[model samples]
Target: MAQAYDPYTNVIHTMTKAMEIGHIDQSMFEILKNPQRETKVYLPIEMDDGSVRVFEGYRVQHSNIRGPFKGGIRYHQTCDLNEVKALATWMTLKCAVADIPYGGAKGGIQVDPGTLSERELRRLTRRYTFAIAPIIGADTDIPAPDVNTNPQTMAWVLDTYSQLKGHPCPGVVTGKPVELGGSRGRNSATGRGVVISAKLLLALEGKTLEGTTVAIQGMGNVGANAARIFYHRKAKVIAISDVSGGLYCEEGLDIDAISLYLNQGGKLLKDYGAPGVTHITNEEVLTCKCDVLVPAALENQITEANAGKLQCGCIVEAANGPTTEGADDVLEKRGITLIPDIFANSGGVIVSYFEWVQNIQELTWERDQVNEMLEKLMSKSFQELLNVTEECHCNFRMAAYIVALRKLVFAEKMKGIFP
Candidate 1:
């Protein structure tokens, strides 16, 4: 029987195995296994009700050998130090696999944003920013949007950081509104990266995106954007889900209408009535008949039990650690081609790098330029991943880890054990 998985331990185990398989040096592997810094902060915010509330917040900078620590700030009820550690470590590996000039870091506040009013959320964001302001900067650690956080959240971060400096410091955060020095395509970068990964994978098999059927779980920033792009690419996005519920149709749901509906607050698939569309549970959406399954939601979703039930042809993980180690083994035994989260959903950070570059250079790039650069990076990284997989005779997930570990371990070697 497979052991019950702890997400952080799972990440460390998989990474360690990849290093061994790739014949990376043990000393470097030892250094890569742990985070460089983990800071936990207690944020006290005065709510609009004139009540004081304390929230737990965390920032974990995993590595900085490649470049500045870069990742998103997640605001969810389940956010904790361990989860933040896993996310930060994934960010490091993701950036390295993409060959981008970034290390990995993640920040989170342990509160459900849904339960907070916009005013309360803003206060919380500012306070959290102030709490971590000293350690985060343009060239040190940059933050963007993640689950339950968006451009507005990043805007608040940029503003709070700048307010403390008494000068505009837009570089402190990416995924801000474009007017605030964010890149043009940073919002949809992760989804676009997913689409690009799909395209590259299909093309390698002499297939194209036009007729592919895709089901995506979690229609937030990443899944929704990926759905839109896949629809635009002529792929039939057969199913999609958010926190509320899921919707499915064999012929394809009208993505444009659904996108518009989702933009309105308090909307959900359970309430989204459309012709020939059927309401489905999140689990049903994952196992629905499709050519591609993109689990863009939370971790530990496709675990051992559910992994066997997945009916998709390919699994493109758009969420961090969406599949458990046991689930990975099952999927591998079944010969399913899965593009792991570290690589499949790396689009967000790649463009975050662009946004950071634009910020540091004090320049803005056109949408086309931003998108072209994103495409180049995604496709190039996909090719390199394939090359490594072929050489190592390993699965995509293992190959991705190996590729990332090589860069990280090599950097550690060059830096040579800091005294």
Candidate 2:
């Protein structure tokens, strides 16, 4: 039987492999293997019906050796300390690979946000924020939105943290509403980055996005935005899915219309209907015919069971740890180029860095400026990855991990042990 998938273990395995390939120093390997701290909080929130419930939440600070701990907070039913640890580690690597001045951290609650009413969610958010406020700050750890969380959630966190401090603390969190000091182009930054990664990869083969076929799993913020951006760039988004299900079109999908429907309210692609669009199971979407398959949803979506069945020419991970280490080997054997999530989805955190800079500097940049800067940073990082790939004679994923591990280990060496 195949081993049960543990994201934390998977990350450690990858790091070990990268270290072996890069011949990195083993002294800091132990330090990098584990998180610096892990905080678990039990939040008691009163529902609109006057009943109280306790939800488990966690914040894993993987490292702050590079800079402040920066990552996202997600509300997921299966969230736990291990997942947060793995995500935190990924954030550390992501910032390093992006060459951004930030460390790695992640927060999550063990409740399905959809099951709660708006008021209940707000209470939960405030309570969770209060539980974690002591550790998170602009110069310390900054939190942003992740799965099942958005700008509104960050707003609540900002308000609660501010209330506790008795002052406006806009820098305490990223991905807030623009009026509250959030940066422009932050929402679509990750998706745009995914497309940019794809474009970069395609260019390596002398191809373009003008007619590339793409399939994206997860119609949430990252996936939806990526779909729209891919459509706008003239790529045929033939398949897209969410938790409910998936929708497919042989020619192409009307991502704008579908995005409109989803944004209207609580919408699911399974219930969405349009001409020339066929509803398919999420599994089918994964194995569907496409030039690029973007797993933008949660982790472990693409595993060994289906890695060999994937029909896409490339996989650009838009979600954190979407591909397991086992699946990575399979794809490597299959000669399927898989871009690791740390680098591909670094757009969100990169822009989060921009937002934090804007907040600290008390300045605002136009959307165009923010986007141009994002592209420039991603392009530069892509070149770095390419150079590392060539130097190490390894795949993109390993090259990225090597680049990140080098930066992190060097920083830790410079800092030395704190006594």
- Which candidate leads in TM-score? 2
lDDT of 2 by residue, 277-344 (tens): 99999999999989999999999999989999999999999999999888899999999998889999
Off by over 4 Å in 2: none
**In candidate 1, which residue ranges exceed 4 Å CA deviation?**
1-4
Every candidate's lDDT? 0.92, 0.94
lDDT by residue for model 1 (241-358), tens: 9888899999998899999998897888789998899999999999998999999999999988988888999999999999999899999999899999999999999899888888
TM-score of 1: 0.98
What is the alpha-carbon lDDT of model 1 when measured against the actual structure?
0.92
Clashing pairs in 2: none
Error of 1 at 146 (Å): 0.6
Q: Which candidate leads the pack in lDDT?
A: 2
